[model samples]
Every structure is written in C-alpha cells, then in structure tokens.
Target chain A: MLTEERHQLIRDQLAADGKVLAGELASRFGVSEDTVRRDLRELAKAGQLRRVYGGAVASAPFAAATLSQRSRHAVEEKTRLARAAVGLLSAGQSLFIDGGTTNEAIARAIPRDMELTIATNSLGVASALVDRPLVELIMLGGRYVPNLGTCVGADTLAAVAQFGADLFFLGSCGLDVARGVTAFDSAEAEVKRAMVKNSAGIAIAVTNDKLATAAPYRVAGADAIRHLVVERTAPAATLADFQSQGAQVHFA
Target chain B: MLTEERHQLIRDQLAADGKVLAGELASRFGVSEDTVRRDLRELAKAGQLRRVYGGAVASAPFAAATLSQRSRHAVEEKTRLARAAVGLLSAGQSLFIDGGTTNEAIARAIPRDMELTIATNSLGVASALVDRPLVELIMLGGRYVPNLGTCVGADTLAAVAQFGADLFFLGSCGLDVARGVTAFDSAEAEVKRAMVKNSAGIAIAVTNDKLATAAPYRVAGADAIRHLVVERTAPAATLADFQSQGAQVHFA
Candidate 1:
C-alpha cells in the first residue's frame, strides 16, 4: 500500500479503536514494525495523533487542543500573572497551585532560590517543579484528568484539605460577576474549592479575555478570593467593583 | 567564600536555583561560563541536577522503589492471573483493568489478534499494550499516582463510566473474608469501585500473600467478583468457602 494510504488507514483505526499499536499495525499493513513506527511519528508531528511509548493515542477528545496550542492562548497574560504570583511566594512556604496553562507558567517562573513545599494536583506543574532542589513537591494522588492535565476526586480533595498552604495559585475556566470563578468540569471545581478553603491566601490567575466568561461549574464567588492578578489594566470601574466586593485586584 | 568554597557555593546555588544559565551563574560566581557548564555536567552525572536546553535544573527526585524493584514482587502470580484473565476475553470485548503489577502482566499477555477494547488506568499497562494492534486501548486520565503507576480522580471515574466493558481485571492491596477487596489508597479504591460497577464480569488478581489480608480502603465485597485468580492453589477448604460465597476461584 502507498505510504499515504497506510497513514490514512492508521488514522481511521485510531478513530475507530481510540488507539493503535505498532506491531498490530505493522502486520496488518504487511510492513515492518520500524515502518509503522515511522508512520506514527510522522502522523504525531503533523498533529494527526499522539505518539505514546509504543503506539499512538487519539489526541485528548474533550479539549481538542495540542500542548503547544494550549500554551499559546493568553501567553502574555499568563506570563504577567505568573510574575505577579511568584512575587507573593517566599522561602520556606508551602503552596498549592491548580493545574492549568497559567499555573504551568507560574511553575516555570518560580525562582530556584526560593525554598518551598508544593502540593499540586497538576502533573505538568509537578513535572516542571521536579528539577528544583529548593522545592519539595508532594504530588497528591488522585484521578488523572487528561484534558486538564491534573488529578481530582474525593481522595485528592481530602488530601488537599489536610494541608494548610501559605499560598494557593488558582486557575479558572471563566471569571464573571455572577459566577465569580468557574471551571469547565465539576471535579476540577471541587479541587479548586478545596484549595481555596485550605490555603491562607487565594489568588486567581486570569488572562484579560476570561474576565467576563462563565463556565458550567462555579468554584467560588468573587467574595472568596483574596487577590485577582491579571495582565494589563482591567476597567477601572470593574476593578473598583471587585475591590468593593472584598477582592484585592492587582494589574500585572 | 574562597575559590573552593565558591565552587561549593555555586553547587549550592544550583541547588537553590533549579537551573543556572551559564552567563548568569558565572557572573554571580565570578567564574567563566565554561566553568559553569562543566559544573552543571558534573552535577547532572551525580544525579543532583539535569542539563536543560540552555542551562541546568535539579534532577527529578528518585522514588524509593525503582521500576525494576517494584516489578519483582508478584511476578509468578501476575503471570498466572494474566493468562486466566485473557481466557475470559474474546474479539471486540471491552475490558477495564486497574493499575497494579498483576494488571501489567495481563497487559503483556493479551493476544494481538483477538480484537479487543481495553481501557486502563495504568500507564505501565498502556505502554505494555502499545505494541498490540487488535487491542483498542483507552487510558483513563486522572492525577498520576506514582506508587500505583496510574491516574485517579472523578474525571478518571467519569472516563471509565463512559463505557461498559465485558470484563475487569483488578489488582488488590488486600482481601478479607469480610472486608472484601481493599486498596492502600482511598482514591484508588474509588476508581476501582467505578471500574467494578461498569464491567460485566470482575476478576480479582491476587498473589497468594495478599489473600486473607485487608487494607485500609475497601473497594468491593468478595461476592461482587466473578473470579479470584491467584498465584497458588489455596487450601481446598478456603476455595470451597469462597466458592460457596459465589466467587469462581482459580489457581494461577
């Protein structure tokens, strides 16, 4: 069969089966395993599939966002929020940061000199923080959420509630006057609520565009957050309105 | 600090700063950039740090049990359990297996030709099955639990609930006459419960040693399982007792 045909067949198989293995594909197509591997690699590079250790998995079905694609959205705002969030952290503090693109950026911005005990639900954040000597990472074991790249459940919620962190960096799906901070998934919302309740301070890291949006799950009301860190300036009237509702608004 | 002390200081600095840019560390230590890179390489080899794209960061912390160490515990029993579990599977049958050493073996035992839909919470199982073509694999995403080598959470539970599988291959931390199947972690217990509820048949894979013991978190009762696949032949009387309770017991 032509190489294009083989690749198309593989894609079809994955769409039908959710995953495709190398050896099975090799024999089915009457090609060597090496050829199949190469095909998978090319398909992965082209954003057609995700190449795992020995095969390929359909890209996350819910989000439909690649790692790079998710990374690009609101990059500047995430960076600014990360910078501001990092400023609140001091040496010898224990912190919990929810998993999201913004929190991942904050994890990267953490200075190496700062000593911290971090408990996180986000695999991306945990993996990023792994290389830091001064940071003692406690990964809360729970159900893995592929789309969010984190873990959440009753056990994760219970684990987070037991620790009182000095700071909690939270990411939201949407922030609005009515919903306050909301998440796309209910499990994630539960985790965020637990983090806020367990931490000494709650800071919401949001990009400018998320300011007026509302998702399905409401994590907490505007009155619950201690700080709102955003990129650039929010409307002065809106900032005052939030401040009046007991939020300390900070423009990065 | 003296020059020798300065080298130590730089090492300390690297520990404090996850990564040290050659120019930045050199400027801070009054050493050449080449010297900083060499220092990083040395630390990397010592397993104290990792070299990144442009600099160095601390290495990922080593867990107590290496992958190979943990793989040794239930080898014989897992092999037997895996074989028995595979016997229950046929073409186009969807299966859910929880993460454990036994399930890892079952993942390896799956025949490549019997078209199957396998869903799992274990990264090891997913990676092992990656070479099998006829087996459709779906990974249940949650927080990566290092000890269990899988993800767990509400999302993980939700993901598992999305499909009704023909069979479930489960690994238990302990099993008792009364408490039934238990797990070391509560979050895992929750995920296992969902797995059991969604599958048509449940097979408990236990090493001889884990039989009759009970862990902290109870996943299900002995009566809930359809089969008990173990490494060794249990006492005939014990087998009879279990059989009376509605479990079809098999010696691996």
Candidate 2:
C-alpha cells in the first residue's frame, strides 16, 4: 500500500479503535515496524493523536483552558504566594484547599516529600495530587459547577463539615477590608464559606486586581480571615486597612 | 541460529535489562544489523516489545496509575467503546459512573461541547470532566479507597440510590453468562448493585480479560444489564453467551 494510504488507514483505525499499536499495524499492513512507528511519529507531529509507549491513542482537542488559562494570569505573583503557602505546611499536616487559580498554584507548589492529607472540593486540586503517592486526597462531593471545577451545594458543605482542617487556603475573586473576601458565583461562595467555617485558620490568596474590587457574593468578613496574601503592587492604604481588621498581611 | 532461538534469547535479554540494542544483538547473533533489525522488527510486530530509537524495550512497564500504564490494556478497544458509551448521553441527562479503567475512558471520551449532568463515584472521572464547562459533575462521597480512587460503603450506596439516572456506566471486574457481573471488592460490588438498581439503562464496560472470569462478589445478574461492551478480541462463544442472556452486545 502507498504511504499516504497507510497514513489514512492509521487515522481511520485510530478513530475507530482509540489507538493503533505499531506491532499490530506492522504485520497487518505488511510493513516494517519502523515504518509504522515513523507513521505514528508523523501523526503525533500533525496533532492527529498522542503517541504512547507502543502505540498512539486518540486525544481530546486542547480546547479546555485548564492549565494555560490558570497559569497565564499573575504567573509571577501566584508563584510567589504558592511558595509562601508551602512554607506554612509541614511533612505531616492536613489542609483544605478551595477551588481557584491561586489555590491550584499552591497545590502544585507542594513539596513532593511532604505527606499530607488534603481535603478539597476542586477537581483541579485532586488531579494535581493523583500521582503523588505520598499525598492522600479526600475529595468533597457535591453539585459540581463546570468552569470553576468545584463541588458546591448542600452536599459539599456537608462534606466540608466532616473534615476538621488545620488550615484553609481560600481563593477569592475580590478581597477587601470593608467587604471581606468575595466571589462572583454564589455556589463557589457557598463552598468557600464552608471551607472557612470548618478550618482552624483561613488564608486568602489574591492578586492586586482584587484588592479594592468587591464581588457581589460575600464569603466571609475580614475578621474571619487570619492571613492575607497579596501582590507587591497592592496599595499600601488597602494593606493597612486589612491589617487594621486583624488580618496579618503578607506581600508576595 | 534458528528464528525461534533468536526470539528466545532476545526475550531473555529484554527481561534482564529492559531493552536490547540493535548493534549489540547483531554482533552477538553473528548476523548483519539488517538481520538483527529484522528479528527485532518481528518481535515488535508480535507485541512482545516496543521498538525504540536504537533498540526495543519491554512492551508494557505496567505498575502504577500513570497515564501510559493505564492506556496499555486494550486501550484502542476500550476507547472505542468509551466513544460509543458517550453517544448515549444528551444535554440535561443525569448519569451514574462507577470507578474503573474502562469507566475512566468513558469519562475522557465525553465531547467537550456536550452539556450533561454527570454524577460519579470515580475521582478519575470527575477529574477528566472537570475543565469541561458544559458538563456538571456530582461526586459521590464515602470512605476513599486509594488504589481504586473511588468512594464506597453506606455513603456511596446511599448517594447512588438518590439519583434516578437516565443511564449508568458500570465498570466490572469480571463478567460471564452464568456468574453474571462481579467486582473484586465487596464495597465496589455493593455500589455497583445500587447503580444497576437506580439507573434506567445499564451498560457494563469490559475489556477482553473480564469476559469469562467471575470474581468472588456478584454486582448484578446478566439479565439486569441492557448493554455489554467488549473488545473485538472477545471470543465469539462468550459474546453469544452474553447475547443469549438478553444483553445487546457491542464489540469495540
């Protein structure tokens, strides 16, 4: 068969079978395995399929903005805050992580050697630790909202109530001395409230954009939060205001 | 040297060091590199090993829950059935998904644009669909089982019975005509029983391994399942046995 024909056939098989193994394809098509591997290599380069150890599998398009979208916003600032957050955690400690880009960064920043039991409502946070053999993850169940990838509703609150966490890393859409920490979505706000109530300590991670802005749904008052992590660009006046409200402000 | 002799030696070399170099093999066999390459090529063609840049490596280094190891077990066939399973879902439809490798593939196979309400007891499933804004996820809560990464016990079964799903994708540890559907763990089997009872349509996703193997605990009778998805490698007699039991058999 022609090389082009072989390529077309591989694509067809991949679409039908979810993968094409080099060995199976080689004997069936009367070609060298090298040739088959070469075809898989070319197909992988064309973004038709993802190459595995012995084969190539059909893949979902990179349409869902999971990593790039989260990492793109406030890359340097989030990294700094994540480093600071990890400093607070020890080898054997349990914590609660609410869903958001900032919280996702903190989960990623966790040291590999640390053995912690992390209870989370965020799908993103759970996935980040799946392969980490030492880290035990307890996922809170609830009515899931897709874009934010968080579990909320009554069930999520009930799940949160079950866990008595040492610390809570809360992500907020808006953080202010007057309005406290806020969220744009009501369901997410509800989950955040549970995270704050169930944990012994609350730390809010926010960028400078959220400093003065107040979102519609209020998660907690300023006094509920113990630590405020902000970017260096945050206004000095706002920092003083948060500190005055009994929040220990930490600049990333 | 004989072809079978060369094959056996190659297998031994691979078992010891995990790889076989083309140049070293040619010199050891006192044959041209082309001859050695041809032998390696045939081994690759037989699925005994995977051809690499300078040599061949052991076909599957399966040990962990990493993505590559998960994809090695009849991935093409599983993916094919997973694609078919997602076709049964529609917008606003609620479904129950149990935890297992086949069920994980089904979760990954969901179209990015399809808007469906997904209720799952699988951490893998929840994570796969987390970034999808259109699909809503409801995670079932229970005692977390690390190896399975699933929720089970009274809480999980209670969670299962609460939802009247349009469909339920049940993952089976074993399947047969006489023994029916079975799971290795008693907790998983209990949860599967609830899923089968609660959903309108029951579909069991199985690779070829589970076709005739019956485990200790029974999840459901063969008559209870509406659809049985199996790989093409599934024996014709086994397929007929399942069909005779009133299930609509689908070969991926």
Candidate 2 residue pairs in backbone clash: none
Compared with the true structure, what per-residue lDDT tens digits does model 2 show for residues A1-252?
Answer: 545446657865653344678999999999999999987886553334578888876543221332235344565577688777777777877899988767776887787688998988876666555545677778788887766667788887877888878889988888877898889998889888888888889888788887888999999998888888877777999889888888888777
RMSD (Å) per prediction: 13.4, 8.8
Q: Which portions of model 2 show Cα errors greater than 4 Å?
A: A1-73, B1-66, B70-73, B87-92, B112-115, B131-134, B153-155
The CAPRI classification for model 2 reads as acceptable
Model 1: residues with Cα > 4 Å off, grouped in runs: A1-73, B1-252
Task: For each candidate, report its DockQ versus the true two-chain complex.
Answer: 0.06, 0.27
- Which tens-of-lDDT digit does each residue in B66-166 have in candidate 1? 12222233454566678887776778888887877677777778887888778777655664665465666665655565656677876577677776888
Candidate 1 docking band: incorrect
lDDT of each: 0.71, 0.76
